[model samples]
Target: MAPKITVIGTGYLGATHAAAMAELGFEVLGLDVVPEKIEMLAAGRVPMYEPGLEELLARHVAGLPGSTGRLRFTMDFAEVAEFGDVHFVCVNTPQKHNEYACDMSYVDAAFDSLAPLLTRPALVVGKSTVPVGSADRLARRLAELAPAGGDVELAWNPEFLREGFAVQDTLHPDRIVVGVREAGGSAEKLLREVYATPVAEGSPLVVTDFPTAELVKTAANSFLATKISFINAMAEVCEAAGGDVVKLAEAIGHDERIGAKFLRAGIGFGGGCLPKDIRAFMARAGELGADQALTFLREVDSINMRRRGHMVELAREAVGGSFLGKRVAVLGATFKPDSDDVRDSPALNVAGQVHLQGGQVTVYDPKGMDNARQVFPTLAYAASAAAAVAGADVVLHLTEWREFRELDPAELAGTVSVPLILDGRNALDAERWRAAGWTYRAMGRPRA
Candidate 1:
């Protein structure tokens, strides 16, 4: 018989995990403290926009795709403790207010609420990204809290699903890392069973000590952050040397040793993960008294931030120095395409900068307008890209959404007051826009 699984927390990670587990033929119950979240999930509507998450959830929750049983959602911890053989704590640990340290309160609360209910034998797995020493602390706490005490094992299984690709990444991960307290544990076996499809596809399964597993997530994010900053730093130098960073990245990316992924140079990196993870990693290093080793991340952070200011200055220049009374259209507001998540979004930051500089900036995004409104309500939002460009002096394409990429430069040139477009993301076709009777400017490109 398949082991019954309970997933605690129903945010992006937990919601997707619950749906995936049910799809894997396990009877799953998803739990959360928020009543509204549980209610929404039970009604078969995912609160956030993740591609294919809703379809998968509904298929399994309604017992459609050969499901052994339907998945359910509840706010009852006692029911979860009694029903599930294995529990997944998928809480979030966000960055604390005005500090580099992480706010672990959510993780602690999830464990505190559920650990005491594990009277019978069960395995409690952690999927939340946390500080290095967190797993050990939680393991000891779980042991003390449960009536079964040491019988209930604790394991750390960090998730690496990027937003917008969460469903596919979860269903078909590149590799699976399980941090167990000892060699040959049930945690690895259960996780293997949970990921049977990906395992069958030959995904590598690595088992390590608890601390190592905890550090794996932070280390991965920090390295990705470093990679993005590395290219942006090159972009700065390329700007000064009259060389194009895009061509340089393309040339260097051919070598398999440095295969291109996050090499695109633009306003720089931001999202729910990369920016805060590096800071939390730095804070953890400082707490461990090894701050000197990760000090270079500070430079990475600085370089990434400087790119934002540089783009603002570019916008200012495009609008003829002072932005007072200048009409500018800011295209795209989400940090990335196909995602509504805007936590520390670079596109919105650039839009806000133009607004602050007294430019009459009109912003438009395919899916991020609602979120952008919550973050920067002062900026003018347009109904569409055409509307945003209507009578504007210049257009700043900050986010590279597919719609923005496919925009007809001829149509946009006819709509705008001035035929000037600055490609902040380096994604636009300069030749196409120029041929359409508009002046196209892009970062890291030689000035026309």
Candidate 2:
């Protein structure tokens, strides 16, 4: 028989994992400490803005009309312990308040709460982005706490879900990596069974030790951050040399060695993962006495953050070198498109800095207004892009949403007090804006 699954921590990762598990034909029970989140998921609703998550829940959540009834939710550790044969701990490992290390308090609390209740043989899988040695330490902790002792095993199966494509990514992962106590152990066998559907569908499964699995997520994030910062550094060079970065990126991308993915340099990378993950990676490396090996990550962090200030300065320049008495319009607030997560969003950061410097800023996002407003309550928020740009001294395109790209610049030409625009993402069409009777400027591009 297939193992029944319980997903702990019903945040973005936990909720999506539970839903995807149910969709794969398993009986899934999702647990969260927060009663409200449990209640929301039990009612087939998601607390956060993830595309297709609510619909996935509606289809599988028990008691919903026309649902498969394979999924459920609870806040009780006792119920979770008795119900699941395989438990997935999907808690968050956020960066520490004042330090660069990851805060594992939530993950620890979840394990401590659930471990004692595992009186039967079961496998506990960790899916959090944690420090490399975390799984080895946690494996011992689980054995020490569980009454079943050796019967309860541990595996590190870190999550790699992109914000916008989480559902699809979970349902059909490109690769399924599992870190077990030993190769061909019961934990690995159980995980292989759980993922048999995807593996059969061609998702390669890489079985490894605990530390390798734990390092995969942070390592992947650090590499991506480096890529984004590398291109942004080239953008800085392009600006100084009067070279067109867009054309340069296009030319270099043809080599297939560079492969033009993160090459569209703009405001650099931001979000929950990239910024803090690299910092935490560096901190963890330092603790392992390998700080010198990862010193370049500090420069990567510096370059990414510098892009935000550069955009702010460009906006100030567009407004005659002073933000005071200037009405700045900001488009998009989330870190990237398709999700309403505003954690450390470069767009909101730029907007907040301008607002603090005496600029009257109005912001608009297609799906991120509520979350963005919560993060930047003092900044004015508009109902639509047109409303945000109306009566503005200079318009700033910060986040590159499809709605922003599809915006008719000609229609917006008559709204602003001054027809000057700055493309922080370098995603907008320069010719379209310039032909629409507006002076357009973007980083690393010549102002023809």
C-alpha lDDT score of every prediction, in listed order: 0.88, 0.93
Instruction: Compute the lDDT of residue 196 as modeled in candidate 2.
Output: 92
For model 2 the local lDDT of residue 260 reads: 83
**Looking at candidate 1, what is the lDDT of residue 42?**
79
Candidate 1: Cα lDDT at 427: 89
True-structure RMSD for candidate 2: 0.8
lDDT of 1 by residue, 1-448 (tens): 7789999999999999999888777899999989889878877888888889988888877534553456988889999999998999998889999999889999999989998998898989999989999989999999889988887898898999988889888888888899998868777787777777788998888899999999999999988888888988888888899988999989999889988888888888888888888999999999999999999999999988888899889878887898899899999888888788888998899888888888998999998889899999999999999999999998999988889989999888888999999888888888899999988877777777
What would the TM-score be for candidate 1 when compared with the true structure? 0.97
Worst 10 residues of 1 by lDDT: 61-70
Q: Write the per-residue lDDT of candidate 2 for residues 1-448, one digit (tens) a residue.
A: 8899999999999999999999999999999989989889999999989999999999999999999999999989999999999999999989999999999999999999999999999999999899889999999999999999999999999888999999999989988999998899899999999999999999999998989998888899998899889889999999999999899888898888778888898998888888889999999999999999999999999999999999998898888999999999999899999999999999999999999999999999988899998888999999999999999999999999999999999999899898889999899999999999999999888888
| Count of steric clashes across candidates, in order | 0, 0
